[model samples]
Target chain A: MAREPGGEKIVNPNPMMSNGNNCQRLFRLLLGLLLAVLAAGLGYVLSSLPSPAPGLSKPVAEHLEASGVSNPVTAVLLNYRAYDTLLELGVLLLAPLGVWSLGVAARHREPLVDPVLDMLARLLVPMLILVAGYLLWAGAHAPGGAFQAGSVLAAAGVLLLLSGWWPGPAFSGLPLRVSLTAGPGVFLVAGVALMFAGGRMLEYPPPFAGALILLIEAAATWSIGITLAALFAGGRPVAGPHR
Target chain B: MSLLQPVFDIVLGLALLWLAWRAVASPDLFRGIVLFIAFGLVMALVWVRLDAPDIALAEAAIGGGLTGALLLATLARLESGGGAGTGRGKDRESEPNDE
Candidate 1:
C-alpha cells in the first residue's frame, strides 16, 4: 500500500518482483504449503485403503495353460486382449505415417566424427540387438516383452543415427513401409484366419496359440522399432539409390 | 532392517516431490526438462519398489529416456530455427499465437 499525491491509498499493481524478491518468496512458500497439505490428505486416504482382491488374476491364471504362454502378462496382452494390442500397434504405425505426411525431407545432419561415440555405438548396438532378441524370446515366461525389446532396438537405431553410421535414407521406401505395417497386417490376417477355422476373431486354437503369438510379437517388435526410429528422425526419409 | 524400508520410502517420496516441483517451477526450460527426466527415472524406481517391473521398464525407457531425447531434439530444432537461447529466453515472444 502507498499514499498517492491525492491522499488516497492505493494497492500496488505488481505484488511480486517489486518487493525485492520477498513477495515472490512468500508466494512460493504459500504454494508449497498448499501442495504439502494436499499431498498429506491424499496419503492419509490411501493409507486407510484395504488390499485389493485379485479380480481377474484367477481367471487369467486358470486359462493361462490354454493361452499358450507361461507368463500371465503375456497371455493377457497377446491373447485375451489381443484387440487392444492390435490397436496399440496401429497407433505406433500411425505416428510415423503422420510424421511422414508432413513431407519435410530430412535435411542431412552431419555425422558425428567423435571416436568415443563411434566406439560406444559399435559396442552397444550389437549388445542391444542381442538383448532385444532375448527379451522377445523371454516374454513367454518373464517380465520381458515386445514393447521393451522394441524400445531397446529403437535405442540402438537412435545410437546408430547419432553416430552417423546409419543414414536415414537407407531405411526409406517399400521395405520401410513393410516393416512399419507388418505388425498390424499380420495381426489382422491372423484374426481373419481364425474366423475361417470356426474360432472367433483373434482367438488362436490352443495348440497353435504359442506359435502365432511368437510370430505376432516378432512382427510387432520389428514394426515398433522402425516406427520409433523413424519418429526420432523427424521427417519422411526420402528414397535414395541405396533403397 | 524392516523399519529401514519405510524410511527409504519416505525419503523417496520427498525426493520425488522436490524433483517434481523443480521440474515444473524452474525458469530455465532446459534445466526443467532435465529435472523432469530425472523425476521420471525416480518414478521408475518407485514402480520397481511397488513390484511392477513391467511398468518400471516402460517408464524408464519411454518416459525418461525417449521423452528426454525427444525434448532435447525439439529444443535443438527450435534453437536452430529461431537462433540460440530461444528455449530459455523469449519463449513466449517467439512462439506464434495460434488463437
Candidate 2:
C-alpha cells in the first residue's frame, strides 16, 4: 500500500499489481538485451559491406544536365524521383490536417511583452526569411532546398509565435489554407498538366525543366513553411466568438 | 589532424549513445525532453560528419528546434490543464475540457 500526498492510504485491490514493478523491470531488461543483440548484428553486417559501394552517382551525373539542376540531390528529388517528392509534399500537408482534426484550438493567452524577445523576433524573422529565399534559389547547385528552407521559415514562424506574435485574422483564414496546400497542389497540377500535354506525369520537358523545378521548389518552400508552423500551432485557428 | 578527426568522431558517437540512453531513461519528463533535444542536435552533428549537410540542416532545424518547442509546449499545456504536481497519473476521462 502506498500513501498519497494528502495522507490517503491507497490500497492495491489487485494481487497481480504488487509484482507489476518487478515484471516491468524484467520486461525492460529483456527488451534491452534484444535490442543490443540486434544492434551488434547490424554493426557486423555494416562492417562486412563493401567499401565505396557502387551507386547511381555516375548515371545521375550523366543525366544531370537534362534534369535541370546542377545539384544531383535536387535533380533526383525534382526530376528522376519527382513522384516521390510529390507524395512527400502530400504527406507534409497531411500533418496539419491531422492536427486540426483534433478540434483543439490553441488557447488564446495574453501576450507576454519582453523587449529583448520582441527585438529579436523583429530582427531574426526577416533575416530568416531572406535565408529561406536564398536556400530555395541555391537548391539547384547546393545543399539547401525546399525542405531546409521551409524548416528555417518554420523556425522563424515559431520564434514569432513564441514572442507573442499571432497571425492576423485576415491572414490566418483563406491565405493560410492556400499556402498550406500550395506545394502539393502545384505538384499535382503540374503532373496532371504534363500528362495532358502527352508527357508522363511530372515529366518535365528538357528545355523547361529548370523553370518548372524552380517554380515547384518555391511553392513547396512556402507550403512546407506554413504547414510546419500551423502544425506547431497544434490545432485549427478558431476566430472571433468561437476562439 | 587526421588522428584528431577519428578521436572527435569516436567522442561524438559515444556522446550520442549516452545522450540517447539518458533521454530515454530520464525520470523527469522535462529533463527527458531536453536530453532528447540534445540528442537530436548531436545526431545532426553526426549527419554533418557523415557528409550529409542536407540531412544535418533538416535534422537541426526540424528535429532539434521544432520538436523541442513542441514537446515543451505540450508539457506546459499538460501542467496547466491538470494543475501543478498532478500532470501525470490523472484519469483522462475526468478532464472533459482541455482549456
Question: All models, DockQ values?
Answer: 0.28, 0.30
State the TM-score for model 1: 0.81
Global fold similarity of model 2 (TM-score)? 0.88
Q: Compose the digit string of candidate 2's lDDT tens values, residues A108-159.
A: 3556799998998999999999999999999999998999999999999888
- The parts of candidate 2 lying over 4 Å away from their true place are A1-18, B82-99
TM-score of chain B of each: 0.80, 0.82
Report the lDDT tens digits of candidate 1 across residue range A84-129. 9999999888888777775544433567799999999999999999
Per-residue lDDT value at B17 in model 1: 90
Report the lDDT of model 2 for residue A185: 95
For model 1, the TM-score of its B chain against the native B chain is 0.80
Residue-level lDDT tens digits of model 2 in B1-99: 989999999999999999987776665668879999999999999999999888898899888988898888777656555311222324454443322
Q: Work out the TM-score per prediction.
A: 0.81, 0.88
